[model samples]
Target: MDGEPGRCGAGVQPRRLTSPGCGSGLDSLERRVRLPSRACGFLPMNYLPFRLLNDRDTFWGLLWSRRLSGSDLLRLMVFIMVACGVYGAIMAGWRSPRLSLYVAIKLPLLFLATTAFVSVFNWMLGLVFRTGLDFRTTIWMVFSAMTLASWILISLAPVSLLFMLSGVPALGTEAELQYAHNGILVTHILVLALSGVSALWVLREGLVRLAAPGCPVGLVLLTWIGMFAFVGCQMGWILRPFVGSPFYPVAFMRPDCLERNFYEFVFGEVMPYLLQGGR
Candidate 1:
């Protein structure tokens, strides 16, 4: 009786079906696919940096899909600056407060400047390699990976400081001070290398996602990484004094910073010494 087609009280004709499936299907899709959001398609800014570290898949998905807003990028950069500053201060703490302050400023500059300098080359390489990313996306990808490296450094700053304090005496004879300087320098090199490796691991999946149909992602990554490192090493050379030395004054930059780059130093000084077999 109630199932009759013309029954007067028959469920109000299902509310006239304003949208196909009554909008429920679309709502379910959004909930299943998107990152945690306060509003539809909008991630909360305060929680984004944590997501960048912990939810790489979702974060990269949003970035690659062009769904991320300017505010999201701004927040990411702010976190990078602060994280770099923290590690920089720790790196220079062995020298003096003044040197610490100087490095705190320089380290963030180093990362940003390196990214800015290599952006054009990076975008060109992406195009030549058919990576399916534009200039803006290419730069963002490189910078974000660099930021993760900085995050790793920040995470290890305390442990680094502990070792530096215990193993490298702040006040000592000339031989002792030289040993301390070299020790701290080598320690930083190792720590930085580790951070770089970790960042690369995290970015591997993202690289696959951004590559074009037939793109050789490994080759593209190699070229891009080589270029970035080539530029970054020279940038670090120019912005020297990161591992501060008591022998040198606490200046913002070395007086001869522009005289020669890292390559020249390696070829002229380091290579010669190695070739001579320490005499």
Candidate 2:
């Protein structure tokens, strides 16, 4: 009876009861349990502790990170050239000989100005996008988009003005002056609307980067003020020639023409210089 039922100890089962395979079913159940898979994969499988980057090192790193494609640079250059040509044609076309030469002389200045504006706008956008502090490529894109928009608006301004004037009341002296003034006002409003839209578009792209602390409010405000002042000064200069001249030809000059010039001064000179100085 001892050999058959309790070989090792009194009232104890055989050693086979406590062997490795005794809990095989329980081990299989435990092995089958697993964590659920993530759909988006936003969270890391393993996360390390956060560490702050060095200020100078981080800045340099960011500066080096921003890069542009050949096509982007080419587009930027073409846009600048086209914008300058359009502005020059608008400004000097009526004056005859001054047309070609003025455009030629002003081309360089226009190029410089447009380039600067694009650069700053791009930098602002980059900061907003939080693209790790790199700004070179961002600026290139901004400049390209703004320049292209400006070219399109300038090209369309004359056609739009002509359309507006076709409906004016042709009667009294007051009516004539009012009509002229309204034409100018409307053209200016259109140009500004286009420029504003372009700026907002550039800003939208940079907003992500700008979400961090220490936004460039001061720089942006200063840029705007500088642009306004430059426009005022240039307009004053242009108008000074005819300020008191009774012989000033209103017949040859459209009110919309003056207003458009004012905007050109703002976008073509003031904004660019402000950004250049800021840099």
Candidate 3:
């Protein structure tokens, strides 16, 4: 009977998967094995402009949270560049057409080069302090500060333009126009100084968090701030006039840098208001 051609013998039987537990168990297994979507999207930043402008706590949190994702960093860097470019164009445009084009071309370069140099210096200081933050985070934090500066500069553009229009005399004799020129330049310098204060605050907060616990946070902060201002002022000077002199013929850039340092530029030239005080 067992060997009969059309008769079935005992054999392994396949189980049906039609039961509720069977299907549900497989789905449950998949749930256990697969990664959650939230796990995949760790701390993704959105609406950066809002966060950057109005949400300081969130901005600081994001910068320090982890290794920066390249996409986020790139977007932030672009915002910085565009803001700086806007400031450059607005500032130099008030002077002359040639100077505007020149500044527009140079501002982005100035941002990148200065950023890189400062970051390198920052990394060295990090090593001295034995700070644990990575180079990427440090750079990102610094750039975040610079972004604030650039935005402030952009906002001041209208104020600067207004001053240039009303304060700088168009057709006066050189001696007569000198006072107007001086006043406009002094006003712009003061506004830019305010912007520097905002940027320094951003940078200082990040640096404090990153510095080694035993490190003299004060010293480290001052050093970085001094270095940044020194390099930046010199770089600006080297890049030449953002506001060209009406006393001279229009040119895209100066033929050469002035034979003076930042201190000289401020005291000998910019802060002449101090020496002439109460006169």
Candidate 4:
């Protein structure tokens, strides 16, 4: 009798969770304990950025289901500016402190300006392609994709800085400087291409979801890319001096920036070779 199970605690009785929703208390407690015990030490709100990168399903789901408020947009814009700004500063560090500061300002401005100029067109194109994307949704989609790219660029800033310091000479002969500029330019192109590809991959599912039955998601994506690149390249040309060539002075914009567009410059340079080949 003394060794009886019920007698172990004497008068204390086992409590039964008979009330509805009572089990939730234990579940909540479990969650509270388990959440803090996570190795990342990330709180729910703080983990949203990571979720944006790795959890495409949830990220797009929230955007598609819920209307994002002004604060949401502002927060996203802030993140974009901060992330892009960091990479921009590092990108021109090899040049000088002034150029780094100039680039840090211009890079984010480039992104924001491009988005602002293209949003309406992008939305209309989405409609034509039957993607069911409204204006706000279209803007948010682009912003979100750009945010991904910004994150990627920021992540690679350290590597870029290393290459800038080691490979690109701050002071050298004209030939050496030209070679260094070419190498740095190519490096940035590759890094940007990778980031663009990754961002597009993240948006692939969302594009499909928005697209109507039988609509070609690939074509829609391509069209959007063309528009964005067309505008963005010209913007970059306008916001030149990001890399701060040793031959050129450190200015926010070149004096001849608006004299010609990027396409004109490209065409002028390539036509000479094309004509020579036909000759």
The TM-score leader among the candidates is 1
Number of the candidate with higher TM-score, 1 or 2 = 1
Clashing pairs in 1: none
For residues 198-253, write the lDDT of model 4, one tens digit per residue.
Answer: 77864565676444556677888888888889999999999998988888888988
Q: Write the per-residue lDDT of candidate 1 for residues 1-279, one digit (tens) a residue.
A: 112212222232211111213367446434323754332234342266665665555455456556677787777678778988888888888888888898899898898898889889888988988777787777667767877888798999988889768888889899999998999889888988988887676555567755565778789888878987999999999999898887988899999999988999999899999999966
Q: Pick the candidate with the highest lDDT.
A: 1
Pairwise TM-score winner, candidates 1 and 4:
1
Q: Which ranking of candidates, highest TM-score first?
A: 1, 4, 3, 2
Candidate 2 residue 193 Cα shift, in angstroms, is: 3.5
Q: Is candidate 1 or candidate 3 better by lDDT?
A: 1
Candidate 2 lDDT over residue span 1-279, tens digit each:
211211112332211111113377335323322112332144321110000011111111122232235663554456556655564444333324344345434543544464464466545544654443345545543453455445555666476445434533334476564665465446544664575466444333333222233545445434533553454345434433211112243222334545556667668888999989955
Among all windows of 10 consecutive residues in model 1, the one with the lowest summed lDDT is 12-21
Q: Is candidate 1 or candidate 4 better by lDDT?
A: 1
- Model 1: how far residue 69 lies from native, Å: 1.8
- Ranking of models by lDDT: 1, 4, 3, 2
- Separately for all candidates shown, the number of backbone clashes (residues 3 or more apart, or on different chains) is 0, 7, 0, 0
> All models: lDDT?
0.74, 0.41, 0.64, 0.73
Model 2: residue 266 alpha-carbon error in angstroms: 14
**Per-residue lDDT of 177-239 in model 3, one digit per residue for the tens?**
677667766886787688788888777766664444566666766777888877887887777
